[model samples]
Target: MRHLPVLFSAALMMASTATAAPHVVASVVPIHSIVAAVMGDKGSPELLLKGSMSEHRAVFTPDQIATLGTADLVFIVGHGLEAKLAQISGSEAVNGKTFIQLSDAPGIIKLPVREGGAWEPDDDEPAPAAGSEAEGVLAFDPHIWLDPENAKAMAREVAVDLGKADPENAAAYAANALAFAAETDKTSAAIAAELAPDKGKPFIVFHDAYHYFEKRFGLTGVGSISDVSAQAPSAERLGQVRDKIIAARATCVFREPQFDDKFVQAVIEGTGAREGVLDPLGAGLTPGPKAYDQLIGNLAESLKGCLGG
Candidate 1:
């Protein structure tokens, strides 16, 4: 009879522990997608930035800040991508949370910020005077999730870290990660095939943000309308871009929905070049586990639609 009471108590404790999953928070939609994949049905992570807002310009609400303060784990791309969120996450109130910056993950391939309408070697750009976001003009590209290979690496790291944070669900995390990696491989191959016809086809982007995606699928972005610092190009710089487009015979210039389209239209005006919209953040798409693949597929389709015959 005494043993029955002890058994009931043990069962109740186990149930309580099982339901107590870690509170996870992600800085952006793409990162949140990967984390959600790993988490599966275990739990859902809070996405800090929900829409087309650029991470560089994100300002958290008081509720969002409070959410970060209470998070058990927070995933971010790092390398100054989410400077504001990084600051908040590093505050003393959030000191207890485990922040996983995927940029520092093993096997992550870093590409330098392309400057002056060409791929600048990483060694060529001047170093940031300090780690401040204002001085991050020469920082390595932060859109790591654009490349499926890098996404796979990040998923592994996320699984490992999530395992560490919640050991009871360790095996589930590993299984989900493996599944995500396989899906990434399959989706990447499909995207590559879809984009194969457009390989080496030159294009222009609103900003120099798609280099990782371009580099991944053998596409060539000859120039970006915006500079590495996201500054509006000078009149002289705009002239240079127009000349570069004419020189490269680029058929299409891509604009991002998050940014103003006036510059894009002005650049392509009378040049006979078509304009296409590329949403790097998956702006209007529903945010969830499926968004990552959808985002990549959308890019490929957008490129093909504009550049392909």
Candidate 2:
């Protein structure tokens, strides 16, 4: 009888220790980086997508879904960024868990999907596509983490959620988020100063993914070769982008390593535009809290190298 009581006590202790920390899972690398910062030494969240894959077309395995089922809190950019996550969002696995969509976070600057016409005004009102206003559906860009300000806001949201999930470590999460936000501001200032000379300088990107970054740093994006869908622009659309590039006298055309280079090369062909690479997702970076800084820095360096910065 004495030994039985000791065994029961040991089992209870193990169970308590196992559930001491909340298990967190983030949808993508950039989001994971921010959440990791908030969690800090308290805990680490699992990254759903581990590499340079496209989040738009990412396929989740059964094991990953199972991991989501086990998470105490889940974070995603939402707005169809991780299409596969829709399945798990409503599943029983996430029934009692907290889910955060960074796109809906406060102070998030949303840019509309650029249709055939020129850059339109930024408004909460949704406008239709160029000609098919009635039939065309309104879309908002989901690449919210490209801007440091948005990232800071997202970090705050994450810290708030983490504090709720694990109240014992609430102060740590808040402190880490504050520290991260300050660092993000510092990095943003440094990047802006470095690229200030080239502010308003025109450039072309692989896709319509850098509007947040461009709008933040005062850079001008002439046009993107691809749309947000990652679909190749139609021949007429490509010609229109080419005309814009030529008209703006864009000095560089940027391509992402995740996508094929042939299209970018063909677009810039005969235009005398220098080719540069811009990786918004930080494909080559090690996924962690520090990777966000590296991603922003790399983007600035890439722009400077190609745009005479």
Note the residue pairs that clash in candidate 1: none
lDDT of 1 by residue, 49-126 (tens): 988788766788888887877666778887677767666555655544436778888889888877554333234333
Count the clashes in each prediction: 0, 0
Q: Which parts of model 2 are misplaced by more than 4 Å?
A: 1-19, 92-98, 118-137
CA-only RMSD, every prediction: 7.5, 8.5
TM-score of each: 0.88, 0.85
* Candidate 2 lDDT: 0.76
Best by lDDT: 1
lDDT of 2 by residue, 183-289 (tens): 99899999999999998788988877888899899998878877664555666656666777788888999999888888787778889899999998888888888
lDDT, candidate 1, residue 141? Answer: 78
Q: What's the CA error at residue 248 for candidate 1, in Å? A: 1.2
